[model samples]
Target: MNSETTYLTDLAAVLWPCGGLLGPGDRGMRRRVRRDRGNQYLPVPSAHNPRVILPAYNRSAATRGITSFAQGHSLRERARTLLLTGAFATGMAPLLLRDRLYVGAGPGIEHALTAALDRDLSIAIHVGPPRANRKPVLLLLTPGGRTIGYAKVAVNDLTSRLVRAETRALRHLAGTPLRDVTVPRLLYEGEWNGHPLLVQEALPVGEQTDRPTRRQLLRCVTQITAVAGVRELRLSTSPYRHSLEERIVALGARPEAAPLRAALRRLPDVRVPFGAWHGDLTRWNIASTARRAFVWDWERLCLDAPAGFDALHYDLNECVQAGVHPGVHQWLDSGSRLLRDPLMSGTGLRPHTVSTVMALYLIDLATRYLHDRQAESGGRLAAVDDWLLPALEGLQERAAHEAAGPA
Candidate 1:
């Protein structure tokens, strides 16, 4: 590729500021435009505004994979594989070892972690605000507060289940075909405070402005979702389908959740392709650098889900938080155009497939909110049932009409 040729990542720089506050730490991707020179390229200088350096993202050569390129993205892939289990785990290197000194006491936790990891620098532990359904995050930092990694623990039965699941998911992905795909590399997993603990390398993401539109983001996510297809086989029936159905029933039992429940019963049969999906593919869980989107938060990973659900989750996350209020129906209709047109163009799903996927996505969102472990924080989904259900039902009607297109 010529230095003058425009890379999709270069185009992405144009959209960074537009995707405001869309990722972890509520940080957005912002970039400065470079002047195109004939057959040549030069880095945009930071001699003017210093803030540009703070969100500084460097894009590598372009590729189809979302976060890292398989062909030339060896920087992240060459990470030293660490042993975290079985007999090989004990007395490991600093970055690979779990803190052996802190049994449970709070005072020595930082000391134990510092000694177990990096002894030379002074360290501080900061407990982050609780994430929905996950433990309060723990940030490990230098005395200057540069982050090393984030730590999570099985704080209770609920968190334990989630933490353990993510550990398994990362390990399951370690040696797989999509090994080069950008994902958090697990640093260590050991017990602390009578529960399981996991520490992972932190990867930051921010987007280039126009290179990845809301449309391109959807395409990028859908591209990565294909990893699940490569990683696992689609089952004739997934236990998760039953699990989601059961949640629908549980929520329906609550009189207030009746609309959400009723909507679930009307979904068209969807085609669920199997593979690992990030589970939570929202702006909050993904970051953008120049070349790829870094996806984190793997606890909800499911091996079986219809193709479009991850993209569906990403699109709906911010909306659900603001409540299922007015204009949501119109917004969903307008937003879904991508799925109907460019997203599924090459896949050959029938027109009815659109309606089914749409209905299922809404039902899945509602299910998540009704049970949102956030304890008083999850459901703006309750409001979604008001207009979105009817809106989804309309998809079915429209799909039927389109299937019988103008005589």
Candidate 2:
């Protein structure tokens, strides 16, 4: 048996006691290994017993299948194919290859990575303080310590595609004005394992009070507008698509169906300039050391979107958190009013439109919270249930109140 086959067989033997097989059926654990020449499908021997003689399969057919699927495709597609074909196993691979997958600069600091500096460096892994998808990020930390960030893909099936798109988008931004706009610096990028890895410098954590201020938020909105005015920002692979709409649809087929469809149809009619708006712009993404507002998480940076979408997204999150706090409501109100004034002046986004969108968004957020009850019970869902959802509800109510007109 070849070394690759031997390695898989050994893994099967070790894991057989705990669980018979990794995935469905007893066709032996399969893995896809990509090399310079081509892709190879390596079948693992079953640990049941050596007495059972199964038919010998042609390795070439499997290799050809993998090669045909991977060649000329983006890294995202390649990764997806690898995972779906059972070539790339999750959780286990990271644990088994922990030594190769991670590098610890010091105690309490571990970064999942893969590198070849002279050639290309790519850091692929998911990151967060703990849980919280709001701040959950997939970062590519480069050689110079520069980092580019992307949003996490929700669907396991499309994870590969999402990663590749994020990588491509980041590389495009690296060459644009948004290159060094905010967050950590970025270096090289490529597919690693089944996810995209970007090598970048890590940013230092600062005091809580150092977060972005009101003026900084205004400035960010203005900067985004200026960028959009020059060129149309690309929103999605499919034209006129809104991620929010997708979320709403996913929440429940019936409760959100009509409204979401209507909102999507109306989205294109709205004349908001779209250019690199942060899809999820909350305080966490914006770090402040009491001097500058450093914005991160560029994966959701779409080219074309509503002018004040980021600002609204940010303020709404704050409102949800501290809506009941003294002056918090007034703060969100004033911020919303201001955001709609100066740069987004001509954009005619009505009160009803904002209210409807906010409501739909909140509902979607709540549904996600419900779906993750198990993870939450494990103490990972604290932020979402305790803070995010409440804050979002507040924003929705506030929007509805405003839409109702003068009291």
Give the winner by lDDT: 1
Alpha-carbon lDDT, every model: 0.47, 0.41
Which 10 successive residues of model 2 have the least lDDT summed?
101-110
lDDT per residue for candidate 1 within 181-266, as digits (tens), equals 46788887877646777878767542342123465566565656666553222222555567667777776465436765555554
Misplaced by over 4 Å in model 1 are 1-106, 115-134, 177-181, 204-212, 230-240, 250-252, 256-262, 270-275, 318-327, 341-343, 346-350, 373-375, 378-407
Root-mean-square deviation of candidate 2: 15.2
Q: Which regions of candidate 2 fall more than 4 Å away from where they truly are?
A: 1-114, 118-155, 158-162, 178-180, 203-209, 228-254, 262-271, 288-292, 322-335, 341-407
Instruction: Score residue 3 of candidate 2 by CA lDDT.
Output: 38
Residue-pair clashes per candidate = 18, 26
Q: What TM-score would each prediction reach against the true structure?
A: 0.61, 0.47
